[model samples]
Target: MTYTVNCSILLTELPLLERPAAAKAAGFDAVEFWWPFAEAVPADRDVDAFVNAVRDAGVQLSGLNFFAGDMPAGDRGLVSWVGRESEFKANIAVVAAIGERLGTRAFNALYGNRLEGSSPEAQAELAVENLSAAAQGIAEIGGTVLLEPVSGTPAYPLKTAADALAVIARAKDAGAENIKLLADFYHLAVNGDDVRAVIEDHAKDFGHIQIADNPGRGAPGTGALPLGEWITRSRELGYDGYIGLEYKAPQAEAFTWAIRPVAG
Candidate 1:
């Protein structure tokens, strides 16, 4: 199986426009990222520059995220938020345009965190509506919409693969047939879910997989998670998609572990 770097977390020291080249320089031919722009819908020039940067770097844009609000500020997602439906809708066209330009097939739509007074049923309904719309737009370019289960954030729901798959099922039943799960091992492990069991049971259902070590959300060796084994098991279970290295490493040297062989 091939590996891809998550430029949003790796090479973050560089500007967004330069990350693709940095990832390329690190011997990665494919890269993924969250929404690079601060705005849900950025200016045309900004979009042009971003697209040009990836092309010029000669790396494949394997995956991208729809706008999820300001990530650094703790806004997990916008689509399922009670009042951000319009913002989420505005971002769909922009995300579709970017995916078409970059030939990215996987788009992750984060489910927003629960609100103070919001009903779980209401938020779930909104998620279904927005994700269905996103799936329709992304499907125009033959892309798949991804739903991920994130951990460590109390307000954000969907902490396990089962949780995400349930939502994906709902979206698919609602006419979004291209939706699938983004199985991030780090999040599942952090939430105390059995990573190996998840892969054994549902690897074939995954559209994409992301990885980081638990406890610190750092590079593989920085923490104690059987990342290499999990990766191998995922492939054994028929998941041939990209295994995105979505970890935090402050320096280039931290990636040296990637060259090491996995223990059997």
Candidate 2:
């Protein structure tokens, strides 16, 4: 199976700008990332540095997330956030520019967590608008906007494949055909979704797939979540795309699962 390493989660030991080279040295031809900047519209020089890093390292930018507000501080995304529509719209240009520069086509847009005062219905409506805008912006680069079900955050509404797919359908109804689902196995399992059933029912609906084992969200073998079977099932059901390695662990042991043969 082919894979792309998620530099944002795996190579934590290296400086942000250096993870691409580290990923290349580790034998991956492609790497992906969350928004790799503090602000939505980062300074031009920072964008240049990120683009140049991937170029110099000779790896493809397989996928990227549009700015998800302050991830470390618990801001999941801006798409549904009541007041930050401008920031998300602003980041689209930046994301499109970077995707064009690095040949990336898949873009993950994390659905925002539910805010206290914001009505869920309103947030959901706003999400479609933001996601539609994102789809249009990335379309110039032949890009597809990805919606994913995130686990662990109680306020996060998209906790199952059905939930995200419904949103994608709504976005498509609004004329953003480039929008699709990002099937992250770890998150689905943790959220109590039957992943195999999801694959069986909606394989072609996936635009991308990210994998990390449960328990600690580590490499595949670190937990017994049947990730291999899910992966094999995903392929058998027709998910012919890069399986993103978005696991967490120290650099010394993060890829231990890859060293062993994958199970079918």
Candidate 3:
């Protein structure tokens, strides 16, 4: 049972480059992050710095998200943002490069939110095209591209596992089988999905998993999500991917319940 800490959210107290080392010092052998750069295609120096940080810290980059646009500015993803198709495609080589260097084979592609003037149908069609391209690009490194179901944003469309899974099916049917589900338990639960049934019937479709307690999105036991129980059950049901600690809490106290996560 390997747990990967999300340095992006957990170790925000430190500089972005320092978080990996912090996770390593916190007894985690693996780490994951949202798209680390501000742009889809960042400068080579920036890319080199990011790749070197993970390597120098001696922790595996368990997963990385594709450029999801200005996250702090409220942009969720670029996979379907009308005319930004090239930006998403351009970001692929950089993602592949980092994966090749750091042995990362799981990549998250956050689906973009709906635009005011664009038809949902148009955005969805573009999503399939971009995802198909992304899957092919990551496939060169034997990586699986992940489609996640997010919560807290009404405009964000994929709020359930089934929603994300359907998009994955469309992308696969478009000829890229490397696309899979990111099964973030926090989002699934927040979106009011039947989390247990999601796992019971579709654990086989999970390419990765992330966790955070509900109500506050805090550490385990801080809320009423029964996160550890769900994670343990996921393992029993055959999801063997790395479990991501993608919660918000005091860095010093976040991993207090990080010991193999067997609910009791």
Assess each prediction's global lDDT (C-alpha) against the native.
0.89, 0.91, 0.90
Alpha-carbon runs more than 4 Å astray in model 3: 260-264
- After best superposition, candidate 2 residue 137: deviation in angstroms? 0.6
Model 1 TM-score on a 0 to 1 scale: 0.96
Predicted candidate 2 versus true structure: per-residue lDDT over 163-236, tens digit per residue: 99989889999999999889999999999999989999887778998999879998988887998888788888
Quote the positional error of residue 40 for candidate 2 in Å.
0.7
Better candidate number, 1 or 3, judged by lDDT: 3
Error of 3 at 64 (Å): 0.3
Candidate 3, poorest ten consecutive residues by summed lDDT:
255-264
Clashing pairs in 1: none
Ranking by lDDT: 2, 3, 1
> Taking the tens digit of each residue's C-alpha lDDT, what string does model 3 give over 5-50?
9988998989999999888888888999999999999999998999
Candidate 2, number of clashes:
0
Flag regions of model 1 displaced more than 4 Å. 260-264
Model 2 RMSD vs true structure? 2.8
* True-structure lDDT of candidate 1: 0.89
